[model samples]
Target: MRVAVLGGGLQGCCVALALAERGIDAAIFDRNDQLLSRAAVANEGKIHLGYMYANDVSYSTARMMMQGALAFAPFFARHLGSSQDSLSISRPAAYVVHRDSQRSPGQVSQYLKTVHGLIREASGRRGDAYFGRDLTTAPRMWSEAEREAEFDPQIALAAFDTAEVAIDPAALAGAVRSRIEADPRIDVRLQHQVTSVDDADGFDVVLQARCGILRERFDHVVNALWDGRFAINETRGLRPDRPWLHRLKYGVSFRLPRGTSLPPSATFVSGPFGEVVSYADGLTYLTWYPVCLQGISTDVTPPEWPTYPAEPLRSDLLQGTLKAMAQFVPCLRGLDPGGLEEVTVKGGVIVAWGETDIYDPRSELHRRFEIGVTSRGRFHSVDPGKLTMAPYFAEVCAGRILQDIVR
Candidate 1:
């Protein structure tokens, strides 16, 4: 039996690869000529564990993100068909900075305790977390006393190294795409948009390819179409009574002034409404979400598929991003957010399913990288939260799909 995988993003590519690994014939359909150009490629190049999810304790495995982080290394090695001891790793130790208004030294210490729990969750009696002693690159803290002098006197409370790595997105996607494309069982269809899917024997999907429209039937259909998945399903009369939702979150990646001295290891300054992630490629500083005042739209309850212009990091967006950056990094003050060179703005809608209860960081809109099968049982949606964990989600979701097909 053949399976049709929709959307050629990270999830779609991974699902196809996983299915092929089990010897199940699969096809991937996507509209982007450069399949990894969208949200999958354009993102803060983080290999996140629980540092990002420390605030999100509502879930059983609030710090369980380390579970996914652990799985990625081997899976990524296999995806690249590489035998190297490690993949492309940029360890710019992560930081979770706090503002004086919201956090105190005691609170910062408590926060570090939570991170320690995450490390324990990630590795048992191990020095490191993700890459040997490398993953847990020794989480360190600059006490409240240390922070007071370096930061804007009033705003800075405390800061710490979160032991996170940054992987090159384009490289990761290219590796996965190249490796998966070489497999004969996995048919890779680029520049092909899945226009619609309907009930036939299993599912009949219409595609608008570069040449013309094409239709195919499959035993099962998997939708890894990020923000657009819901709309595509809605067209098929598959509405969500209990549905997973998607929203657009924008990010602005910019370069700091030359000779700006920063911590040798510290990266991604994090506070309540301020975040700055230094990416692997270009070493560009990306700020967004709760930090940037205008990252989320006024009302994108159910965000539309982002119709971003060919080159659009609107002036207002850039302005807001710089403001957020200064809130965290005092050194970034007065750096012009303009004069963007090459790729600058990166990000799109992140998905959330089920009931999200927290506000802001742990809020309903928080990002997750997990997979799901629809109630219909035949279709699986790649509802992801983070870039680092997409492969793990695909592995689990692929197993579920294969089990059904073989039975």
Candidate 2:
């Protein structure tokens, strides 16, 4: 069977890999000249376990995230042909509660305990399936003294040690690219911008390439574009019923200064705070929500910006993120001016359902459970929700497409 998978981001790569494993030929169409060049590579690759969604009081977001987190390592490792233990995992993150957080430390703590309970319950007999580590252990909250030592006492109220870690997106992209290049069943059509997908006997995928327009028919089509997935979905008459949002956020990464003691991988939660991830490969990533988030669009597709922003804006984001992060983690103050190396600031588009910013308690962005594959016949549109859910949803999409063949 022939399949066309739009967008060469993590979701599209996973979908193509899954189908190739099943002996199905698939083509990945992406505007970028390389796979995983956009959101897949630009952001902090947090493999979230739902600790960030304390605003979703119903715990539905926690449940959905737990399901995906469990399957992330195994599914990704299998497709990448690598050992789970070999993945370059960041250090265990400390969830620091900001002083001006939307949810109080007590409330966020309760939510963390509840989410951990769900994770333990979900693991069942699949011990150590999550990144090859036991997830049954309860989360540990730091003492007042412990929190005060690492964080500014005025900005950080509490901190909890959780097993949540992020995979290095560069390493992941390289691995996936190697696997895709070696596979004969997957054809990657780079620099091909898919303008639309029309439903006929199957699906006609119209592509606007540098040369000219090209059309191709495929038995199945997967809309997985990180930047323009919604726009393509609308062309296929698969408009999202609920309100949606497309946000642009930036991630700043640099090498830690020589002789600098690395700060713990940390995420400020329950508000519009930020995260600092120090990966094992010596790449430290920082993102301050208030400073690094650039724009928002209610339109079907977000405005296009260069992956690497220009000089002054890029420098501004770097300095601003460092300043904002140092407010909570004081160690970052030293690395801002001239202590760091190879600093880069890049932005990626985040698509989710919400009209309000994250600071609002009533915002729909707090709950991200309303995402996955929505299919009409053989055409599939995927919203992986978060980067953590990509591999899990890819498997689901492949299974659904296979089932369509039987009917």
Q: Return the TM-score for each candidate structure.
A: 0.81, 0.97
The count of residue-pair clashes in candidate 2 stands at 0
CA-lDDT, candidates in order: 0.63, 0.88
lDDT digits (tens) for residues 331-376 of candidate 2:
7777755556888788788888988988787999999999899888
Query: RMSD (Cα, Å) of candidate 1?
Result: 4.1
Q: Give the TM-score of candidate 1.
A: 0.81
Model 2, runs deviating above 4 Å: 83-86
- True-vs-predicted CA distance for residue 312, candidate 2, Å: 0.5
Error of 2 at 27 (Å): 0.6
The alpha-carbon deviation from the true structure for residue 210 of candidate 2, after best TM-score superposition, in angstroms, is 2.1
Candidate 2 pairs with clashing backbones: none
Lowest-lDDT window of 10 residues in candidate 1?
A: 292-301
* Tens digit per residue, CA lDDT, model 1, 52-103: 5444444333354666677677676665655324345664554555542233
